[model samples]
Target chain A: MTAANGNVRLAARSLAPAVLVMGKGGVGKTTVAAALATLEAETHGLAVLVEFGDGESGRRALGPTHKGVEHVVIHAAEAIQRGATPLFGSATMAKLALGNFAMRPLLKAAPAIRELAMLESVRQIVEARPGVRVVVDMPATGHAVAWLRTAKQGREFLGSGPMFELCDRVARELVAPGRASIIVVTLPERLVLEETLELCESIALDPGLEVARIVVNRVPLPLAQECLVDARALAQGGGALAQPAAALVSLLEARAAASAGAVAALEVFAHGPHAIWQVPLAPVDPSARDVARWLRAEGAA
Target chain B: MKDPRVIVCAGGGGVGKTTTSAALSVALAARGYRTLIVTIDPARRLAGAMGVPITDVVTPVPLPAARGRLWALMPDPRRSMGTFLDFLFADEPEAKARMLTNNLYLGLADAAAGVHELVAMNLVARAATEGDFDVVVIDTAPSRHAIDFVTYPARLAALLGGRTVAWLAGLAQRSGGATATAPRGLLSWGTGHVEHLLARVTGPNLVRDTANLFADLALVRERFVALTRRASELLLGERVAYALVAAPTAAARDDVLFLAARLEKLGRRPRAIVLNRADTQAAPWVRALREGHGVAPSITEVLDVLEQERRTRATAADALAVELRSKLSWAAVVRLPYVEASAPEDIVAALSTELDAHLTALLPDAR
Candidate 1:
């Protein structure tokens, strides 16, 4: 591993039990999820980062597709279908054709198919190896809420069916205190924060689920108080900096207010049950790996 | 395809799909087409943007300034289902009344995972074909994938296959309604794997009632099939156009790409991609203030950081735009500036004027 990888390993030593990163669209959930997964891999020996879609995003992260919905649904459907199949003397395997028919329709008709598939896939990943954890980069807020709600909903809707058993199992994995937790990632803007709060409020509503952490990403770095005080004093002298100072102060004020709004949201979030972390605005856009490295350094700091 | 009868904006949540629909409606209305924009955004930003309150029923938006007529509605799916049931059994009043008043039917309809999509499809199809509005714009739910969850072509037809409906209706007519006699165990309350599971879960009483409701639905299955067929045609027809609205981020563009791909498989692709809230690069005056006529040494340090950050953001935005173009097949990509307008009216008004010239030149007359 490179020095950057080594640094992440050190930081990963104390990650929370499980992490699920979610936010509104374009709120950097993928980068945050990737970062957390990298840090998780450090302590856990191996970590799986799962995306719920076509597995293209997963391919970008870990090369080959690490069992997501597309792969899991078929396996799950076959398993469930086999449950309905009788022991011996089955006719032409035609009874099982219904199973294949039911796969996409079941997954599509009920949110349960996708939900159970995703949850089971994560469980399989962690269980496949010793000391491994899984991080699910959940979809945006609206569907994320639906995805999270499906386990219990499936149990309620599909009682006694093979699908119900899986839902119950998934719910148990999610509910056990330290077994799983969700981390909400959001920007420092007002609208985004409002949406984040709405997400947190829903997370709080789920009975057994825990809000692990909230990362407020892409915040402007605060200027040094002394530097600002000196600048204020020097602006009175009116040199080459006067006009820029006037311009800078207003811009600085907006930046400061945005940061303040983020801090203020944290204060509100603190009333709820999650720990919060802030990621400073980067000079350049950072990828998932870069975010992981930065998070490690941030954790160290 | 400027004057297409329908424009549907699909994307992930909070990517300004509703705003894009509102703006497109405004522009089309300005171009002298009577327009209606339907939004399913629970946030209901459309009404706020139009300076009106959206209802389950369609309401004409107060467009004192815009030239053409405009209306908006948020379909309450259950109510739409009720109305649709009426239409389905229009010939058989007794059957329609019996189904409408049935508690089991109401429960099934209310709990329907498929009804919402069906209702949305019905509304858009009607807005295009039945309603007097010259143009209909749809702002759908922010589904997670490119193939959105809330709406898909012939979705109900696929999920509720004709054979499955026919079989259920046949059984229900024999056993559920007790109109015909049959030997037990075919679709008996206790037999058939699907019915067994349903009876086990919902209890025999509810299952029996639901089976009876299906018998009634069977009486109207032909109409339902015809309706879905109409919905499918309205969607894939030449008059409809799809557009993708995305923020200038990897995730949103990723959704646009996925949506474009999915639409392509259906032979229906997005006509335009709107990149919302794009950062405006520095102006000549601002550039001069930073480089040419610099003042205030105290502010110089912070100013330098701010300028550097702005440049970085601008570069990133441009790169993302280029990346989307390279990845996706759609070409009519437009960027809306990240202006500071909060209210819905201001956003709609600003977007209308801002998009007028560009949209006019880009969009073509419908064939």
Candidate 2:
């Protein structure tokens, strides 16, 4: 690690880096978060990755997360059951609890009980290990907003339940500077990039939450400037079998245009110069190692 | 399309799920099935595809090309929940108003994650019987949340379990007697007497009016349960067909496999898997411009790079398709090329063509 890396690395340890990796459903959030965790674990000692939903994506990503890294998956339904156990008095209460939640007849009640339960679970994990790096792999854009909204509502609605206390703690930690950073991942497709920028704008509404850089994933690996010029010169030389050269420049240019538009939007939405990172479009699926290395390289750049 | 009773297009977000939902509805309607396609959080682009505004009210889209009627709408959860309340408290007018106005009941039916699904399924159940629609196509929220719509009945049933209803009814009964217990014409009692009377009958804080809600909704709990069960039965039962729509990415492919496994665990399975945007031809213009014409080196270089990218993407896509087929042994995985259209309708029209085989397989004789 470079001296600059050492400085930031030390800062991260002091601050207890907690990042919420967010994106649309198809965007590679798990891939990016796991890769970042793997890097932190290699650089620092303690890092815990948390997934909010029930899916195995987080656990699967954790397998390659370097040693000493912890993986904690919070299945919302199960968490709610844990919370409902006292009320249900037994497993049979699971159904009634789920129904009441669905109907949301109670304040701070709704299927969002899962989000509430998940928030409480995250707070415990963060509080228990003060200096531990917490990486939360959040759900997609739409559902993610719902989770954030729940944090705000839980504070207002639940007068004095254990839920209100957890929500207050989480809401504070999530917005605290250097304590939590939200990283948004996006594919370079026109629509996906635009949607991501919109998400960044919406997340900005939360005065307490701090959004990090936008990670534009799966950008086709770009060639050096001189190499592209040479390719363009060769293509302009009219000849047989010159089609490949022309297509390369056009394809690369198209990708550059898409990225530029998204970046421009990101800058405008962020209200200042925003940090934007790009990941090379993978030839095949990338492993955790590939992503970690790529992140390091991007960081250096 | 087999029975054309119910069709749910489900997958993670950004996988073209919303587009797939619209196209399937268009195709099903064209094939002579009276269809209602309900999308949640429909983007403006998609709402524009139907050539009409898809709002809270169910509006029929005039599909000039389709043989049967086509209708579309985004479920209004508040309204649907109200309808549900009306059905539940149809017998007791005053009680219905109280429950509707109650903070807890209103809140539950309003934004509970399952509220949409509950409202949607309620809509679907209604459409299945009295609405006279041959097919009710559901386009759900992506990810595991999509499954929330399918399993919502259970959660809702538990919410209104027999005991919860009994408790509410019993409260209402006691409260009714308390109203009478106001010492035979309350003009004689002072204001303190009235306050005492209310305190005695209303049960303490939190549980106050708890009985009234039960009393009002007591009659419809069984019917509500019946409605929810029937909707879920339509979804998981033999009458429904499931299609998993996914973009051709390794991550999305992995999710498709997981979703299939999840469904299988529930004793259900996707009728077919729709692998959308499968064509690795990331840039279509390059292929069309370069084939036989001898282009300049600059153009050729660009073409070559584009071709290489395409080939690489195609290879990755083929591998994912192979993995999907191998793992989902029972499902027929259909691949759709990268749809080039930007306008919502054009994309839907293009996807409908790509999904022709699977749709045909579902209906067989419709076309």
Compare the candidates by DockQ and give the number of the best one: 2
lDDT (C-alpha) at residue B233 in model 1: 60
RMSD of 1: 6.6
Expressed as tens digits, the lDDT of each residue in B245-363 for candidate 2 is: 87666567766777887788778888778877677454444555566454445545655665675577677678777887888777777777655333457678867765655675444
In terms of lDDT, model 1 sits at: 0.61
Q: What is the interface RMSD of each candidate, in Å?
A: 5.9, 8.0
| Candidate 1: residue B9 Cα off by (Å) | 2.6
Docking class of 2: incorrect
Candidate 1 chain A has its poorest 10 consecutive residues by lDDT at A65-74
Per-chain TM-score of chain A in candidate 2 equals: 0.80
DockQ of each: 0.16, 0.18
